[model samples]
Target: MNFNQKELVKSTVPILKTNGTDLTKYFYRRMFKDHPELKNIFNMSNQASGKQQHALAGAVLAYAEHIENPEVLINVLKSIGNKHVSLNISPEQYDIVGFHLISSIKEVLGDTATDDLIEAWTQAYNELAQIMISIEEGLYQSNLKKSGGWKGWRAFIIADIVEESSEVKSFYLKPKDQDLIGDYLPGQYLSVKLFVPELGHEQVRQYSLSSAFNPEYYRISVKKEQNNSNSPDGIVSNLLHGKDKGDEIWVSAPSGVFHTSFATDHPLVLISGGIGITPLLSMLETNKNSLQENPTVWVHSCRNEKVHAFKEHINVLNKDSQWLTTHVFYETLSEKENTSVKEGRIDLSELKDEVLIDNAKYYICGPEVFIKVQYNSLINLGVAQEDILYEEFGPQLLHFN
Candidate 1:
């Protein structure tokens, strides 16, 4: 964008800070009203909870703040690009989003939206859109070139479902074509699209691949999100839980930036809270199977054993793998059966001797608040910022800086 356009977008920073969510909320409503089919690609549950709008608002504000140097936002953009690929977002969709976004800006800004201002934002949006499209194109091409990979959604049948816990179940999905499945990094996630009868539209949700790469099937451990006072029940997850074996669901190829590298033999620390253990399980398993005998630690926190998934599997791994160390914390323990298990929430300060391996890397996954707490704890323990990586379950909301 030109200097004038950059200046204009930057000038809107103050307004964006105050009315950003309103603008994005308006944009979504406007877009969905005109093109109802797009609803299939979005998570309406997050829309209802205002999370999608808030996340978009934050992203827009950040873009405006850094309009002069978009390169700085490349990492953030790549993260979003990974998510877009998982949802099978296409380049044509960008035109629709741009139209609605520009329209919302003008409508919300009222008479203050002059022609030059509109044009400026148009150029800015286009520039940012191009960057995203380019990034997504690269991701799409990479997936296509991979063995057993394809663009867009592919049909996958639930070959089997295993109960991991009272609330969590693992769905073993195999390609409907009976072809080999593409391999993915241990921490990557794939999107599942399902039709929701009550909502009268399809919903897409991403779940981490809970197992190491498999040629026959991809396993995703899902936690049934029960309705509560704070939020509505998870539509897709509940629908998945109700699905029978052999039922078909549309799945996108695995895509995510928060994956560990098997290239290095560095000691690794994997920490998780509640249902966040899904991705970490893959990492632990992959590490166990790797030729390198890197010392690895698994630290998990959950309510109790009843809701804890993969307990026996982890125990067997712990027992068999000399390089693997395990630690568990239950908010309320039913019984003191294991010496490695503790009572109450995760306290890194207490696990200093266990988790504070020299030159080890830390990977955390959990709810927004839980991730923040663990991130801060790691910082307090003097872990380098660059050494710690995290993946939030929903919209990116955690800001460590």
Candidate 2:
């Protein structure tokens, strides 16, 4: 971009910081009004909760803040690219989004929407879109090139459903054609698309592949997202829970920026809160036989034993390994429990020696608040920023300094 355009974008940073959410909300409303069919790809549930709006708002603000040195946003781009690839987002849609986004800027800012400012934002959005498109294109190509991978979506039959906990069920999916499935990174997730009867449209949601990467089958543990005080009933999850063994669902190739390569020699610290343990469980399972050189620790927090998903599986694995220490924190007591149980939220202070040590890789996932607490705790304990990684299921608003 030219100097004039860069200066124009810089001038709008303060406005975006203050009203980004409102602008994004308008953008979604206008875009949806014109392109209602897009609802099939976007999560309308997240839209209703304003989560999608807030997420885009945060992204725009971040982009505006780092417009001068866009390289700083590489991590952000990779994360979003993984998500886009999983959703099978098309490059043509970028034009649709850019149109409505700039329109929203004009409508929201009213008198302040000068032609110069609009032109600057248009150029900026185009550049950012290209960056995202390039990253997503590469991800799509890589996923398709894998041994058992394919582009778009493929049908998978639900071979079995294991009742993991009161709220979580593990669905074992095998390719409908009985062909080999792709080998995904341990911490990755798959975008599962289901036709919702009530919503009258197909809905897509990403579920972490709950078990270690297996070419024959993929397992995803889904917590029935019931209507809580904070949110409405989850459309796809409820539908999935009601499905029978022979039901077929469409699943995309596995894609996610968060994964355990076991590449680093750091002592692995896997922390999770509630249902967030799904992806980490896969990482743990994959690493159990291989983590001989690097000592590993699994820390989990949930409400109680009843909601705990994989006690038996974890216990079995724990008994088999000398280097793995498993700790479970339950907020309340249960009728029966294991010796590894504790009664409180996760506290890493006591385990400082294990977690705060140099080269310790920390992977955390959970509710927004829980993940944030764990992330800040690790940072506060003096862990290097790059050493800690966390994943959020919904729109990610969290960032580290």
lDDT by residue for model 1 (1-401), tens: 78887899999999999999999999999999999999998888788889989999998999999998889889889999999999988889999999999999999999999999999999999999999999999999999999999888999999999999999999999999998788999899999998889988888999999998878899999999999987778888889999999999999999998998654479999999998999988888787677785899988999888999999999998898899888899988765556567988899988888989899989999888888889999999999998899999888866553
The window of 10 residues in a row where model 1 has the poorest summed lDDT is 332-341
lDDT of 2 by residue, 109-170 (tens): 99999999999999999999999999999998888788898888999999999999999999
Runs of candidate 1 with Cα error greater than 4 angstroms are 336-339
Instruction: Report the lDDT of model 1 for residue 218.
Output: 97
lDDT of each: 0.91, 0.89
Candidate 2: Cα lDDT at 35: 97
Model number with the top lDDT: 1
- Each candidate's TM vs. the true structure? 0.98, 0.97
After superposition, the stretches of candidate 2 with alpha carbons farther than 4 Å from their true spots are: 262-264, 291-293
Error in Å for residue 329 of model 1:
0.4
Clashes of 1: 0
